[model samples]
Target: MASTIRVGVVGCGFYAQNHLNSWHELRREGADLTAVCDVDPAKAEAAGGNFGVPHYTDAAKMLDAEKLDVVDIVTRHETHRPLAELAIGKGVAAIVQKPFATTWDDCVAIVDAADKAGIWLAVHENFRFQTPMRHVKRVIDSGAIGRPTWARINFRTGYDIYKTQPYFYNEERLAIADVGIHVIDLARFFLGEVAHISCETQRRNPKVRAEETATMMLRHESDAVSVVECTYGARKLPDPFPETLLEIEGETGAIVVGIGLRMSVTSNGQVSEESIGSPLRSWTSEPWHASQEGAFNACQHFLDCLKRGVPADTSGEDNLKTFALVDAAYKAAEEKRAVEPENWRRKA
Candidate 1:
């Protein structure tokens, strides 16, 4: 990988706008936006025109034509495996957007393919990279909260998400699979790996086809416990629509992220509080800036790893652990019992 990283983007849907803008903004930092591809010609053209790059409807054509160091696949879950496999075939690193894929087998296939090729593959799990979330992790790492023992993480909101993603209205695995995965991932981020997980789900929104609310509990390997909650049907005034409110307790003290991204930490007989909100950027807006900024940070991490010849924190292998929690949550809800997360092993 060179300091001047040549990059190609493979999806141009709703969320890909942020990816395009982030990559464009990173131009000063050495990310050369080489080309973009989408099956929809209009979308491909729009993205390419807007970003001033070549566009293609076929992914294979774009990959064959460009000398890209990385191909950022921002497509939906169902397309992740195939696009990843294609990129692996071309020997290009990929940053896949999460929900890793539609199923555990699909995610495993992508990871396995990348592993076999020895390619740098990562899932775009951006929540943990959010400014406020990073601040929380920083505090924890600084030992301000000592050894984390328990946590309650929630991403409850009634925002009209369907307006932007009407396709989600019919997803078979709505809450837990769609948005709860981020909250669940955050739980794993704050605590350690899960020993086992239990969950209860509900179809709170009559209009939705699947469960829109999920309440999960996890027992961490380190004896820490976490209660994780996610929903798209919460009714609240001035809703914390895109904010993740959490409370983490450790051996020495605790950390809490309340409404408005205000964080409070009580550490070793001392207390401090501040607003740990997302940083404003030219491409960011209210309510969505946290997520937008997180995408930028996640991309930066991937780019830096490519240049440094290292693996990402959210590498394909590591994210399998997070995706396993998702599978475990669904199983727990269905079986009405606590379920251990399924672990993956590389073929010898």
Candidate 2:
């Protein structure tokens, strides 16, 4: 209670509502929902009214007004850089939404700013924080799957995502930037850092402006290989929308995460299988609950770290590695060859 971290959330839009809800749910764990901000007065007023927190149309004003310890940047990718800079500039810790920024350079700039300011900055990359994925990680750590040599992480669905966020149809970097980034992050989470990547992209949906399907091959630094794929073009019965199916093979055994959140592990020739589905919370719903819960879990982790004055698991510096993979994937697709992800820290 005494260690409660006063918090402010910016951008009360479609996806941001999840962050706001999550912060409220985290109050018991010492996250004080101090304020909320958005450019749209109606949206800000609506969220403020519902949450019983003061809302403002200006982020700077809210930051100046509230004695906040942390600020969650839930705005669009383009706004992430400046808003994060604003938070760090004020010496307040910041938690930014994923895709970190619109470009690799911007991502670097934000990380550098946080470093220079000596403030906590973390990216909200929550796919690996999903309940199933956490279970998978625990299995791997327990040595049931030894030295993971190969993995296949898949996210395919035809759910009407655009219906909820129509702006997706016009995004220049559609699928990979939107969802493939999550799958790619999962690849790193399951295996290790990528050594190089080869990818193929498709514009299966005639209506979308950019690629909606991305199939990738990753060579990890450990010489392990993985197939990472995501698409919004699949037309399957009982679509597992928002679920990521996985198959990981190691020296000792294998782990398979299939439809309906079912997971099976083979160790020492013994097979064990069960449902690893995410549970629904009062503020969560079907299909989307897994993702929403992940957001909450990620927020909780960040808050815990902030209170302890430590770097987050998805700290700004660490996420650059994941962002690099996304950048390299697009290049690999264009050239039809493998490309090593860019590392900004290499000595010149």
Candidate 3:
């Protein structure tokens, strides 16, 4: 194994810039960002110029030309399967951004391809890596919250997200598929695997083409229950646009995370207050630091995992659990019944 990992990043759009910045920052940590690619020439050129790396307009071309150990697929969900398959065919490890793909079948296809080829694959599921969420998980792991029984995970905001990604306005599946997926993953992170899920969807924004809000209830395999909520149509003061807030109650204690990244914990009749927030980075800004820092942390995790020859925390197979909840939530809303999430049956 090489001491330095060579990386090629596809999709240099709005969010991929964070991935670029992160990889560039990790050069000191043994990441060699050797190449970048985007269908748009301008995006490719800009990213290349910014990061001082070769850029290509075609992902296949970039993969063929670069001596890359990994390819980061930061493209749209619809592009994930093909990009991942391309990387896997070339024997390069892949890290895809979430929704994973447009549907469960597509997500599974990509995972299947990776598995058959024995290529390392992971989804850039960053929410759980955010500072506040990490803090909450640490507290839970320390047994301060003592087996979480009930919880609510929410990411609601009225901020115009369409400003950066205008395509969000026309997605056939918006809320749960876009932002809610992260919150649902958080619910599973705090509790455990879901036994079933029921959901309600709302198209509160009259101008939007799809449901802009979703409220999902998950019954964990452990019998614990969680209410997962997300929306882009919220009208509120000081909206936590990019923040996830939740309340987790266990047998012995509870953890409540509120606005401003403030967390309150009650363990064994004792209470404590904590401000758990991500530190702003040179390439990160306020209101989005948590998300930006999370992207960085997630990339770092992928690099470390690749170096150690270990499956990522959010490996492709593992992310299917999170993506399954997404598919089930949409189905449960449409069918007006609880739906069991479809699990991946690995090929033997």
Tens digit of per-residue lDDT, candidate 1, span 61-141: 999999998999999898999999999999999999989999989998888899889999999999999989999999999
Which digits, one per residue and each the tens of the lDDT, describe model 2 over residues 64-160? Answer: 9999999999998999999999999999999999889999999999999999989989999999999999999999999997999999999999999
Enumerate residue pairs that collide in model 1: none
Clashing pairs in 2: none
How do the residues 117-138 of candidate 3 rate in per-residue lDDT, one tens digit apiece?
Answer: 9999999999999989999999
Let me know the TM-score candidate 2 reaches against the reference structure: 0.98
Lowest summed-lDDT stretch of 10 residues in model 2? 339-348
How far is 178's C-alpha from truth in model 2 (Å)?
Answer: 1.0
Kindly give the stretch of ten consecutive residues in candidate 3 with the minimal lDDT sum.
339-348
- Candidate 3 lDDT at 198 equals 99
- Order the candidates by lDDT, highest first: 2, 3, 1
Model 1 off-target regions past 4 Å?
345-348
* Index of the highest-lDDT prediction: 2
